[model samples]
Target chain A: MRLGAALRSELSKLFRQRGTYAGFVVVLALVGLLTWGSHYHQDRFKVANELGPDFVVAGKSITALFIARAAMDVAMVILMPVLVAIVVGGLVAGERQSGTLRTLLTRPVRRSTVLLSKLVAGCIYAVAVTLFLGLSSLALGYLVFGWGDLVLFRGGLAILGPQAGLLRLAEGYGLAAAAMCAVGVLALMLSVLFDNPLTAAGLTIAVLLVSGMIEFMPYFEQIRPYLFTTNLPMYRACLKASVDTASISISALYLLGYVSAMVLVALWVFSRRDVTC
Target chain B: MSASSVIETEGLTKHFGHIRAVDGLDLSVHAGAIFVHAGAIFGFLGPNGAGKSTTIRMLTGLLRPTGGEARVLGRPIRDRLRVGRSIGALVDEPAFYPYLTARQNLRLLASLSGGARAEEIQEALKLVGLDQDADRKLHTFSHGMRQRLGIAQALVPRPRLLILDEPASGLDPEGLAEVRDLLRRLSEEGMTIFLSSHLLGEVEQLCTDVGVISHGKLIAQGAVGGLLAGGGPAVRLRVDDARKALSVLADLPNVMAAATGDGSIEVGGERDSAQLNELLVRAGVRVYELRPAHRTLESFYLETMRAGKSNDRPDAEKAENDNDGSG
Candidate 1:
């Protein structure tokens, strides 16, 4: 019951802040831009150029699924992770800097309970923002461009029917949301360690950027598979004509392990830490 | 720990690196009665950096003590959540989300403490005279308003004990009186309040009991009236031939004498005014008038701090006045 009340309180605070809506608005605007840009310049599309003039990429072929997939590629790789970091970074450090953590800790609620509630709330926000981006891009794309069979260039060229395409899109979104949740939890851990929200959020982004660099660089090839960033784009596995369940499962387990480890470290530090602020 | 005490500490200490913010010190506050004060309003007094806030933080479970132990409401301080159930604390300064309204802030805080009814929040607002501004955002609140809201939050959960730090720091005289009245009413209803403040006058008026700490050690603790009475009697006198009188009174043992601004002599330490008069007269100094002097809590506090310092170091400076002894 205490945990429930704390969760409710946490969620209420998260939603009431104007910054929370700013993330969604930004996501929607980006999706809208991407869809409009794709509509006006279909011939310039990379998929069209790769497939040559034999397969026209204009009109009925530029579907909602394509827009969502394009948006996810950009959003999950960069935009969503940064947004998630900013939101989760403020969870503990912002309160500490503002001197509100002292107020919150003095209450009858357990420190572990408070940390758990915040983690759950951050995860909820991650899922909500991820789904909003996916659905909003799909809707805006459909409004501008008509639906059609989904074409794929990932792995090998294999066309999918509308039903199978939508299923793949949903699966991709779910995996991306799970990855973003891992980022949020990682930010939460940084928030516990730092007193300044900006420092925590900036450090989380730096970690993301450096990890992304390591994942793509040839110098880090030996350790590429071990990096969490290497697995962050595992959602692309769902987009393939023949999904690699084994690889996706490994990535999912790695993310789950990362989140669990972050949660435990956060809870331990928060419980024993002094609230001098 | 006594059964009637609501707070008890044995050698409670907190060391921040090399600085001992709170040294090994023992403290106690009774539940409702049988303490120094008739009511259970424990006023923790100390000079700046004297560890009053550190002690209050430990009692409220905001800081961990380096050594020793403390218990609030019969539970050890380590059981913070349990101890928090019966105590409402406002540590350091009152802080809330600037975008949140007064009512919303209260509701958020209330939900953390097992929840509070809307009526309870309203009543707390009314008590703090913020009922009309309950819907207003906290960003618009002044410091005095924030202090009042801090007190109101402590009352929202209707806890058995209220621990406040500097509860009257920024209040005007009018606000001070209103808060004084509110605290008096709360005490009348049997709430044990432990507060730390630099407002000696307000503490004198509102608190039944006070503990004075200096250099991280508690030097004095007792009823307001009893502690003040312990200063002993001081006598003011008007004497003819002030030079001779000073010379004559110097011969008297254990008597401290100083001249007042109005050309009269004030003497303390020795209770009897008549003996001094006779001794001065026989020594060729005429004694004109003699009367007892009044000592205030401020004077007592300064004198105790002086004495505490002197005792802490043998080479310390002498007291400003001869009568200024640690009571």
Candidate 2:
């Protein structure tokens, strides 16, 4: 019951601050821009194909699901983590900086309860941003390009009917939300460790960026499976006609493990930490 | 722990890295009448860096003590949630989300402390004289207003024990008086207040019990009157011949120390003023006025610090012994 109150309080404070919604606005704008760019490129492709290569016309149909998938790809790789990092990074560290955590901790609430509430709030924010990005992309995509069968060229050309494509997109969005939550949890752990919000957010993003870069290297293939960033792309697997269930499950498990480990560490450190500020 | 005691500590120590912020300090605050009053108002008296704030933090569970244990309202300090619910605190300064209004900030804190109703929040604001300004964002609040808001937040839970650290540090004269009256009123209403401040005059006016700390060690703890009336009851005699009065007072068996000053002789020791007056009358010294001189907490604090400086071990021990003897 106390945790619920704390969560409500945290969410209220989170939403009241303008910085909290800034990330959402940025994500929505990015999605809108991406959709428009895709539509414009698709129009250019139609003109090019009509004037020249018949082969280009075979793989050129821009379906709503395809636009969503493309937008999700961009979001997962860059904007989504950034959005999650900004909010989660400020969860604890920002409060510490403002001296509000001192006031909060002085209440008749356990340290663990406060930390858990923050973690839950960060997860909620992560899910919200991810879902917003996914839904906005889908809405904008359908508005511009119209719904149709999704064609993919992964390994070989595969075409999925509209209904199957829509289901895959939904599954992909769900998996992407989970991945973003893990990223948010990781950022929260960093937030608990640092008193500076910017440092926490910057370090979280930097770690993600560096880990992602290293995960793709041929030499790091052996350790790639162990890296949390490697599983971020696992959401893409949900887009396939014959989904790699084992790989997707393993990726989900990895994200779960990462989230659990980060939360545990964060809880331990935060509960023991002195509120010097 | 005694039933009347609300806060007790046994060698409670907190060391930040190598710096001993709070040394082996033992303190007990009884939860009964202070002097003639029905409630206790303990003034945690100390100079800056004297570990007053550190002690408050530990008692409030903001800082973990390195050694020893403390109990508040019969529960161990480590039981933070339980202890916290019973105690309302304002540590350092008032801090809130800048964009949030006074009412919003209080409401947020109130919810954390088992959910305070809107009327309760309004009442707290009214008590702090912030009811009119409750809708103003905290960023627009002056330092004094923020301090009042801090007090209001502490009062929101209607805690049994209010632990404040320099609560009136940044307040104006009117704000200070308001706080003083608020705390005094709260104490009278049966709230146990334990506030730390270097503002000796404010503490002197508001507190019934005082604990003097220096260099992380509690030099003295007892009733404010006892601590201020150091050594014994003091009498200041205004006489025609100060030297003669001093000489007369020196011969008195009960008189401890007598020194002649500007038109008066300050006498220290346990002795009746009437008896001394009679002695002066018989000894041929014309006594114009004879009044009991109460030593202020400031003088007592300074004397304690001076004594500690002269002989660190014996003075601290003496202060503690004095406290015990008086308490």
Candidate 3:
């Protein structure tokens, strides 16, 4: 009965968050315009500096492409957790705060079923949102910018093979999604632990923010390698000269550890909680 | 206990540190009977700390009793999940997602309960008289309507037993009447109803049997008419002439006292109405009313509350139990 009809109950609540829709629209507009403008700048410089009288430009036109690519990469990382905090944080706390938990628990379902169902729904939303970002980038990069060759970083600049690049993009998305999923679960668990949604969301975001700072510290780098927040950006490593999967794998394991712990705690608390509100 | 009994609780004791919300209590609710608990209405009742809510929560598998046992349909309280399919309870104020329409809320509850169909949700809505306003968001419902919707949601699955906590608290007079009729209809169809309330008059009218719990203990329990029939208080005998009936009863042997009211004589102690009636007729006094004149559950519950004593009955425990769900 946990995941029973209440799963849809949570789902409907998620869709009701006006911020989610707003976030989607904002992401699309910014990413689309950024990619197109980058694409425009790339072609204009090529036609002017190379095809123009001087004929100075060579193979790839270097006009704002790096900035656009970097912006896209950063946007991808920021999109997942930033846009999803409210949904994830509200999972249990929102219901508890609003007294819906009593309504939900009165039904005949296991507590774990309810938590798992909500986790699965959050995963679905995360996948969809991340994919939206990735696809929009691909659209701008190919259709508008013209898919001749993609510039790169790491050791030295070199163009990427689309087949290989696309795979790397997907892998990065997966790693990032898994990391965000853990964050979402952490927020949900906190939601269960706390009675206020604002408290849960605030604490969750604060944890990620503080951990990110510690991971960047000179001495904490080693410990940082174990943090899920640190590994969130590891997806970019897929495009680096020497791909080191060691950190990504470590991050995945750590994310899994946090997710399980949070889920277990949530069930333990909810099962015994009295409907006091 | 007869086969007509549906819910029986024995020595249902629950303690929280120094406070006992519910203490040594024994209760039996007969099948096809609407039983009410009224001691809880005027002031705090149940164990000082182990409240009756704790008891209901344990029965619903939401909490574990400190010391006690309860049975429904002869099934002991355990983790078997049998009650999930049969029991519907509103232990206290019920909550629902404010954004969801009443119909959506019921449908979802049905699906979660494992066997509730969409049609059953509709039936439940109709049963609670909520069909006309089923589509409204729960936030917009008045307190009374919210209470009705809560009832509708619980009944959606059509469980064998329905536990309502103050189900009519928020209803207006008309709404209360509707609920009274609805409960009667349900019980007529053989559904067991256990409702808790503070309205003695209403409970006395709606419930066939009544149980009084004070300080977490069931002080008195029985059929409405039976409990009212016996007493340790004044009895008023209405007859053609109060003076004649008083004189006939005054002549009875070992008579302690007698007082006359309009067309009646109030008697106390040594002689009962039957003995008093025999003396009246011998004295040539025409007697019409010889029944106990002032027996009511309302006054009975008040007496129990004033006494502060409770029942210490214990129920049989579940032989085997297994509750292994997420929460």
Candidate 2, residues B1-327, lDDT tens digits: the string is 454568888788987665667778888544322212236888887766678888898998889999987888878999888898888999998898889999999999988889888999999999999999999999999999999999999998799999999999889899999999999999989998998887888999999988877767877778887776667766778888777776776676645444432445666657888888888889998889988777666656665665555455664445444444654
The Cα error of candidate 3 at residue A75, in Å, is 3.8
Q: In candidate 2, what are the lDDT values of residues A1-277, reduced to their tens digit?
A: 5889989998998888898888889988987888778767666534244335544545547767777887887778888888899889999999999899999999988888898999888988888888888788778888887888876555445678889888888888889888888888989999999999999999999999899899889999999998989887788887655688899999888888888899999999999999999
Off by over 4 Å in 2: A43-60, A217-219, B29-38, B232-294, B313-327
Q: What's the true lDDT of residue B148 in model 1?
A: 95
Candidate 1 per-residue lDDT over residues B127-169, each given as its tens digit = 9999999999999999999999999988879988899999998
Tens-digit lDDT string for candidate 1 (A1-277):
4899999989988999999899999999999889989988886765767676687555356788889888998888789999999999999999999998898888988889999999999999999999999999989988887676777777877677888888888999999999999999999999999999999999999998999888788998998887878887778898776789899999888878877888899999998888887
Arranged by TM-score with the best first, the candidates are: 1, 2, 3
Q: How high is the DockQ of candidate 2?
A: 0.65
Q: What is the C-alpha RMSD of each candidate to the true structure, in Å?
A: 6.0, 7.1, 9.5
DockQ of every candidate structure:
0.64, 0.65, 0.36
Pairs that collide in candidate 2 are B4-B31
Model 3 regions more than 4 Å off: A1-9, A16-22, A29-72, A76-79, A137-148, A161-163, A217-222, B1-5, B13-18, B28-50, B232-293, B309-327
Candidate 3 global TM-score? 0.76
lDDT of 3 by residue, A1-277 (tens): 4464556766776777675577678667877777666656666534334234654435653323333344447775555576666667777788777777766766777767877777777766666676676676666556555554445555534455556555656776676666667777877778778888888888888888888889778988678667767666666676564467886677667777777877888878876665555
Docking quality class, candidate 2: medium
